[model samples]
Target: MNGAPSTVWFDRKRIAPNVPEDLESIDPMCEEIGKVIQLEVDQGIPRNKIIVGGFSMGGCLALHVAYRFQQEIAGVFALSSFLNDNSKVYKDLASSDCRRPPLFQCHGKVDPLVLYEWGESTKDLLIKAGVMCQFHSYPRLYHEMNKDELDKLQAWIDQTLTSS
Candidate 1:
């Protein structure tokens, strides 16, 4: 992760979604990111050794890729991010028997762009669907991430990826 990011950034030049989420827009991007994950597998890397996550809209895409791909990874985290109601990730995890890795979701209590309530709702949905989520909230934080959360997230990553 330090030197190999394996990033897949889709151009954000398309029309905005008419609804809460436009699967049409999201699917293609997820497909490309999925390709990256698959490539890792093809290269003999175990799926459980990979970790995928993002911030804001990128976080939303990461969730889609993780659940749609439906394989175990080291972990996932969503920072100041939220998922639309009835997100397919919920549906997929609810129906699948895969062993999902722990999730490390964090949000600011005062975030305006992605509301704190929205973040909470996303956590609720994921938990309700039986996903293991470690949700964190900052009292005076905003839409951006901070050192505290990053430190905690890094620790979580180390623990999750450690060979136990």
Candidate 2:
């Protein structure tokens, strides 16, 4: 329901093999996503109604895309992800002329993979940079979404899409 009103889902068939050897090749994946989003806009989708968001690795990609092409998207919602090249990307975010979206970040306190600290750190950086961001931390849940998180996201999207 979160992606219902102006639901333009951006997806790619395969982004390499998700292996360490193929990690560097993921740039194509990012390009694919950018193409999809651009295709939608070229076809006449208004930029502000487009939201860039995803889960885990996709979440990270969403944030990167939002930062890189901020003027092209309306907002971003990231779940359990990280900004890997912190110095470069974070600095870009800080200095870029891109408009900060109404960003939402959700993470589990017990996330073992990316760790809760990653989310916390990103949240802090975003906040420090004056982004319109909302962060929610789930207690005891691991590196994934819980039902409550889904519900809140649903509500947030509903409110955002329906209102001016």
Question: Against the unseen true structure, what C-alpha lDDT does each candidate score?
Answer: 0.79, 0.70
lDDT of 1 by residue, 1-164 (tens): 33454453433322122135667778898888778888999999888888889998888788877777735777788898877776778778888887666789999999877888888898888888777899999999998999999999998899888952
- Residue 161 lDDT in candidate 2: 66
Q: Give the clashing pairs for model 2.
A: none
**CA lDDT of 69 in candidate 2?**
53
Taking all chains together, the TM-score of candidate 2 against the true structure is 0.77
Model 1: lDDT equals: 0.79
TM-scores of the candidates are: 0.84, 0.77
**In model 2, which regions exceed 4 Å deviation?**
1-27, 85-87
Backbone clashes for every candidate come to 0, 0
lDDT of 2 by residue, 71-155 (tens): 4567889998666534234666678766777788899999887778877787787777767788899889897788899998888
